[model samples]
Target chain A: MSLLAEIAVSVLIVIGASFALVGSWGLLRLPHLMARLHAPTKATTLGVGSVLLASMVYFFAIGKGVSMHELLIVLFLFLTAPISASFLARAYLRAHVAPDVLPPAGEQGWATFARRSDDAHDAPATSATRAPPQD
Target chain B: MSDAGLLDHALAFGFVAFGLALLLNLLRLVKGPTTTDRVLAVDTMVIDVIALIVLLGIRQSTQAYFEAALLFAMFGFVATVSFCRFMLRGRLVE
Candidate 1:
């Protein structure tokens, strides 16, 4: 490999590794589940993406031709990370927070853990009164 | 210094850094207060592990590990989705 290519690979690897390190640090030190969620999903995704880019560039420079497989992992991570985060957020809301405590959802109703309008209609009107709002 | 020597040094540094990140992620996984936090830790670990595998592939100049990394990403996504689904629905299957 050429010296220039080696330097580029080194820079990419270091940046990627640093991002990963900061991301895990956030995970360890963040105060709450909601706050901690932001750290890993965004930073770790970028961290891994950068590292994969380094690998692709390194292989290309080494006369191994072009390797496109790493792109698959990048695509998968981007697509799934937000979805899993969303699911977890909804789960946390459903288990811990009462519907009335949530910020009003306007005309559409609660964004997550929305009881079906029909179920809302059939249940005792006092159901909302029984469960105290958390936070 | 030779190009190979530089590359070797960089790879060594990368391996150590990524290994440390992985260990810290495990720490969060064990100590996280909520199930959601643990799930997020595992999610981050999966990404870090993928990065480590790609770094290893670069160091070794091998293409075989690419497929392993891709497979691992797929598995991690599936696991996260299912775990979230269970948490959301209170059951794995409908």
Candidate 2:
């Protein structure tokens, strides 16, 4: 291993480590689920890429030929992380709303009554509470 | 290995940093208030693991670890896709 090669390796490693650190920091600092999703999705993907590139350089510089298989992993990661994040967000929204579709403010009944009264002028009082004007 | 000493040290440093990243991600996994948070944490962890495997390959001077890293990446993708599909459709089978 020549001095130049050693220096190059060290540089690569430092770059990779810095990326990982940034990704972690983003994880801790970001607010909310939707916002937090961006941190790992972008930072971590680049972090992993940097580290993998460092490894490839380290091995190949030493006469190990090309080890580009890590590229496949990078490809897969980039493809899936976003999809999962979106799906999870959608699911969270659905679950959060399922229980509160109707609030207990008595507003629903009032709206129904108003509509019934408008439709059945002949029997406003009876139609208001009985059903909904059968319309 | 003198010429490569600095490189080795740098790689080692990367390993340590990556370990810390893993810990931070784990914290997110533990403290996430929503399912999306947990899923994001898991996704980040998978990425970190893949990076770790590649670093290990460099450290050990072997190409074998690449295979494991590759597998992890593939599985992570599949798992993420399936989880997302489940979230969207409310059922993995459907």
Candidate 3:
């Protein structure tokens, strides 16, 4: 590889690795679950995206032929991270928070708790109510 | 210096950093107050491993790890979604 390409690859790798470390650190240290959810999903996604870009460029510079397949991983991560985060959030909500405490959202109520939250007895209070989920 | 001088140093740094990140993720997995936290930690660990695999591909200049990384990403996402789904609905399919 040429000098410029080598430097670029190194820089990208370093940046990607640093971001991954910081994101994981945030995941471990953040005080609240909601705050914790945002850290790795965003930072590490970008972290790996950088590494993938670096991989494409490094291989191209080494005369291995152009390969654009890494973009598929980037695109997949972008599409699914949020969906998973939403699922985790809904899981947290369904398992922990009482629905009545939530702000009103029409007759149907919020989709997460709408089916079971109305009964009140089912969820009770917080995760302590994990027993007898009923279904 | 050498032909692979700066690049080798960077790869070493990258490996150590990612390895440490994985350790931190494991710590979170162990100590997380709730199940949601553990699932999130594992998801992050999978992503970090994918990135590590990409770095390996770059280091070896091989194309094989490319498919591996992609498959890891795909499997990680599906696993995370299913775990969350099971948690939310109390059933994997509903």
lDDT of each residue in B40-76, candidate 3, tens digit only: 9999999999988888877777888878888888999
- Going through the candidates in order, what is the number of backbone clashes in each? 0, 0, 0
Candidate 2 residues lying further than 4 Å off, grouped into runs, are A96-135
* Of 1 and 2, the candidate ranking higher by TM-score: 1
Give the chain B TM-score for each candidate.
Answer: 0.92, 0.92, 0.94
> Fraction of native contacts in model 3?
0.77
Expressed as tens digits, the lDDT of each residue in A1-135 for candidate 1 is 788988998888888888888888888988988888888888888888888889888888879888779888788888988988888777677656667766655565654554433332333222233333333
Candidate 3, A1-135: lDDT as tens digits: 799999998999999999999999999889999899889988988888888888888888989888878888889888988999999998888887776566666655577764453333433234432222221
Q: Can you tell me the DockQ of model 2?
A: 0.44
The better candidate by DockQ, 1 or 2, is 1
Full-model lDDT for every candidate: 0.79, 0.69, 0.83
Descending-lDDT candidate ranking: 3, 1, 2
Candidate 1 ranges beyond 4 A from true positions: A116-135, B1-4
lDDT of 2: 0.69
DockQ for every model comes to 0.54, 0.44, 0.61
